[model samples]
Target: MKSLFSVSVLIPVLSISMIFNSWAQNPDFPWPEGKRMALSLSFDDARASNPDPGAALLDEYGVKATFYVVPSGMESDIAAWKEVVASGHEIGNHSLYHPCSGNFVWSRNKALEDYTLERMRSELSAANEEVERLLGVRPEVFAYPCGLTYVGKGERTQSYVPLIAEMFLSGRGWKDEAPVDPYYADMAQLTGMEMDNKSFEEILPLIEAAAENRQWLVLAGHETRTEGNQTTYLSMLRKLAAYANDPANGIWIAPVGEVAKYVKEKRAEMEGNLNIPGISRPAEGETIYLTAEKGKGIGPDIKYMPEWNAFGWFTAEDRVEWDLDLPEKGKYEVWMEWSVSDEEAGKPFVLTSGEQTLEGIVKPSGSWETFQKTKIGELALEEDFNRIIVASGEDFDEGALMDLKALTLVPVGK
Candidate 1:
């Protein structure tokens, strides 16, 4: 039997160390065997057309794509879906009843606005169980139904993204505007660009741009019919497979899970090998300050407060990152300057450098204005460039993570 998925075979001549060092200074990701970019073709809803001409066309070119299936929709096409699995394609969970916003009249009966976190979790778990029982493969990835991720309306609204992050290897969103930056992307919410109803000519530009930037492009669609609403035309798929398979085009195409796994493994490899000596810190090590103004905040709720020279309005989903190039490899004692209300003092946060992470609990400084400096923990530094991230821990709930002023990294023993 063929493998469930395929990955680009790395060339034996290029050592992993050599590849990491070469791309250490360059911004572009080092694709396997020097491919310019990566692409993943995925279809949602598991429409009958997907297993017929869609998977068939892909198999002809030795391409493996991802199929996010609604388990309830798979009853009529079990045989064809088994063939899809046999041909090395991926099967992902697309929920059970395909709940969407109540705005869509057809889905009003199964609307997300009426759901609670517990109910959504039950449905997702049931869907996984059904899919596994039917297809003999438990899905490792997921797709948000109708691109909607929340479970309620207004103040009651709760994002189920964290749930997906905990349950699957990755979760993909629909109708996203850009390709994923492997370096900074949140794996749980990968961007899925639409390929439905687009001609090959229309899609070529997106592929070309991704190539230039060495990014990962995930193309999503519904059916595989030649002409229909929400359909990924067979003609376009043929041309795309041909273009990607051509070595001259410099594209590495694979299933979504395969590409995501590769990106994670490569990042781990790169971070693991950063201990090699190349630069030197001064005899008297310097204290590196990552001020709030200098840090880049990601996610919806984190904000910079110029009045306090700090970042405030933090939530569990928010993260603050700082890019640095350490002059030497050594242990650095980490310290955080922040303030939080007494009620929010127990929230936990983690500081990560490469593979090492230092976890600390938020200290109560009485009020947000009264900042306190506390030594969190120490982490070993890498000589090369590193992205330091401070993120909320699993235990965080309704309270704010903290109002951060700055993070300091002082050399432990200079």
Candidate 2:
């Protein structure tokens, strides 16, 4: 049985239009491959231990994580750090000088209390530039140094969060209580759950909580050790890796940039669906436009919907092929728009992206004159070009099942 994970039910106070059909699934919540939630392990400060045995351990588990580093920390052992980057671990800007509150005493000399927002911005920019110069990857994600976001003192204090958002795809806050809600999480200040000084036993609850609601769980850590003050236990890391790698657990483990990109694309697609006016913009990922006699590689012998523009007369052997390019790999929600006749209402059809296949039902829309939009299912799309094929099901008869219209692929977040 499918569980409809509920998030607070509200007793409607205002009058709702009866005309509006409450959609069964939430398009806004983009969980891919039926995953329960997302998990991203992010380490802060470029300690020697991080790129050393730490990267090796992660590589062994086939797990990739984000390392937010101060360029200076890795400067002495730049080659080792480069190896970490080459191992598929993401490098995030943790600012040039790791500044913190003046109250810490250690940061009193170069405290945030004396610095301005402009100085912080410049520091972050320089950090990115230096990291890119050394590692050849410009970080699109950022983590606050010392988990602090403000600069200056008292009333003069200003948050550098806005500046970070302007520069990076995402910014993480440390020791946060909740996981990020893809529908509502501010990507600039993604909540970073505490994982430092934790055992796998202590971390499992956090993961379970996030999984319950399909939220994005970001584990924030400092060192990668077992006996240190702020160490994220290596044992815990291994266990987490094993859990995420198991398909039965239903967790999508990825780097910060990869997850952020998918969430952004999915959110944009949801917003576009709600945009009634001329405000909707183009969506990301694969989009095949096949309005009857139009689009690429669609055979010339096609039939159009009577008065509806798009073509019809789909045969069991006929298939539409579209070239799909994906920079950030994930699962995409496939949507099909077409007109259906009474006889074709129950016809079986299949949509595929590589090895991922989605079986869809042909729903009736009163008559073939009306074109309706419907969700087929989700399919995994990897990096680079994907040949998305659409054809009839094995049991489908070789006849005009439905009219050919358009199909869209939007990356779903997990």
- Best model per lDDT: 1
Sliding window of 10 residues with minimal summed lDDT for model 2:
272-281
What tens digits encode model 2's per-residue C-alpha lDDT throughout 140-211?
A: 999987778899988998988899889999999998889998866789999998898888989999889888
Once fitted onto the true fold, the runs of candidate 2 whose alpha carbons sit more than 4 angstroms away are: 1-28, 272-414
Q: lDDT per model, in order?
A: 0.82, 0.74
Which candidate leads the pack in TM-score? 1
Q: Which ten residues in a row have the lowest lDDT in candidate 1?
A: 14-23
lDDT of 1 by residue, 205-314 (tens): 99999998899999999999899999999999999999999999899999999998998887776652221212222333688877775676665566666567777645
